[model samples]
Target chain A: MKLVVVQVLLIVVVAVVAARLFRSRGARAQAIRRLGVLAFAAFAVVSIIFPDVWTRLAHVFGVGRGTDLVLYGLVVAFLSFTVTTYLRFRDLETRYTRLARRIALDEAEVRGRLEGGPEH
Target chain B: MNTSRQVDTSGVWLVIPLYNEAAVIGDVVTRARSVFPQVVVVDDGSADDGAEVAREAGAVVVRHPVNLGQGAALQTGFEYVRSRPDMEWAVTFDADGQHQTDDVLAMLEKARAEDLQVVFGSRFLDDRTTPSLAKRLVLRAAVGYTNLTTHTRLTDAHNGLRLLRRDVVERIDITQNRMAHASELVEQIGAMDVRYAESPVHILYTDYSRSKGQSLWNSVNILVELILR
Candidate 1:
């Protein structure tokens, strides 16, 4: 198979996105994510206004068609979205676990006091 | 019951993570309370009256408002045990009555005799526990994966029966809120610099526990959780 410029670029971008899924998470990461989203939205508007722009850009990147480029972009976006959603749910679970544990312990403590304390 | 031969196990607390095991939880709690005076059953939002049964059977029941997994229930029990200054040891026992109280006493004895901080109840240490061929294969694979990932080497890593000293219990923070927590616990304990040993335990696979046992397919889920975490 002939290696195309777009293939190499897509591989690099996908690798970076995958690595970002496991990398550091903080204000900086959040800023970068927001910036990516803003850029994506702006590009979406541009593509909608000028549909031929993706074909011209695709030609520069050695891709077959604009639709192919969009497909590749969608794959990367979906992968990152899945990973981020999973991590966010995990964080939510941890927080709720701690909260539920506190309530359970506190309730048990109150019940113990009301019952004259835990029996040995 | 000879009072003179009784060992002073008042410092030991049995932490049983209870779910909807209303059929056998009462008898399990009663039997465990007879051997270990301090028993705390963490009820993980059971629809049945298992929590009430545990309470009536003389166990300190800690009820979660919603249904959390067994791992969350165990952590709740651990937190509850940490609050009590009188508890010097905490044993994580199963609520399904598969775990033997005698094995708990033996593990405690081993911990005390060797001055160990952790004593894990391993079914593969001896031939006492007989699981089916398929179940045995899954357990073997689990232990193998655990040993490969963690620094510690053990015959069984997914066993629910474990004796942990107060200090070790205080340091353990289980984040996996499901079946994956077993491997997570072993991984955390392996990372900690604590003296640990494994004792042979007989896991009785009664009809009740057999029905409640985790499906073999959960091993795949556990692996995904560990890897994704």
Candidate 2:
């Protein structure tokens, strides 16, 4: 029963992420992501229903346990997500700093002109 | 013939970035004004009357729209200085009243006499500016980290005082908008192959600066930024 609930939750999350990826407006990229998500979701559901199948698959990869494989994949996925998000934020911050600096310099120019000379 | 007497500061521009430093900005501006004629204070969106205070203290004031960090503020000042064709040398000074006018004079004179591009202040070069054991340890660690990363043998890595040619400031861009900029500045200087020298200067530590000092968490964050960047 617990395994069934876990599989349902995993499928729901995968569906949501895959839906977002589908709407991301890239043809080849979206198709590749959709295929990847579907494959993972199918694997998760099959592993939930047939626990021995996961063990067998894990053995093919020289792993002792299926749970460990899933855990390792989750760790890699989470780290990649974090690093990509951080890079995006850093780019945004650089643009923001440039905007702030431009505004500050413009204000100084106007103020300086109003005062009848450059700002000292 | 005294080379010191011949060192010219007629084209020097002083840039001071102030953030809610109404209490000490006036005194610092006044002191800096006596040595350097062209003083520009970048007000980093302070809530108080820091802009008015600095202006009244005889320095030109540039106001930012929002609270950016010191690095942004200094960049704004650099932009302002760059716009003026009369300026040739630029100095970044702290508004916390910790730096001395004599140090600025010394660095400026050195930059002029030696025809160097950049001059950094080194407190460790002079024993007069002794800090507490904890602060010293942290600074030493900072020095080690900066030297390792930047590959420059700097005696003091995080000192806030510097004198550089206006062209040098124009060449290197400041992206780290906070405390991390100090490390970034050293790294850029090394990368640009800019001729740089370190001068022995004294850093006065007061209760106010100690109270407003960076926390250990912020230091860790700075290290992460440096490493990641």
Please provide, for model 1 over A52-101, each residue's C-alpha lDDT reduced to its tens digit, 9 standing for 90 to 100.
98888877777778898889999999988888888889989899989998
Each model's lDDT comes to 0.90, 0.81
lDDT of 1 by residue, B95-182 (tens): 9899988888888888988999999999998998899988999999999999999988999999999999999999999999998999
Model 1 CAPRI quality: medium
What DockQ values do the models have? Answer: 0.80, 0.40
Worst 10 residues of 1 chain B by lDDT: B1-10
Clashing pairs in 2: none
Q: What is the lDDT of residue A85 in candidate 2?
A: 59
lDDT of 2 by residue, B1-229 (tens): 1233444667889999999989999988987787776899999999999999998998888888888899888888888899889888888899898998788888987887798999999999979898888778878888888888885889888888999798798976888888888888888888888788999888888888878877667778888777554
Which residue segments of model 2 deviate by more than 4 Å? A1-54, B1-7
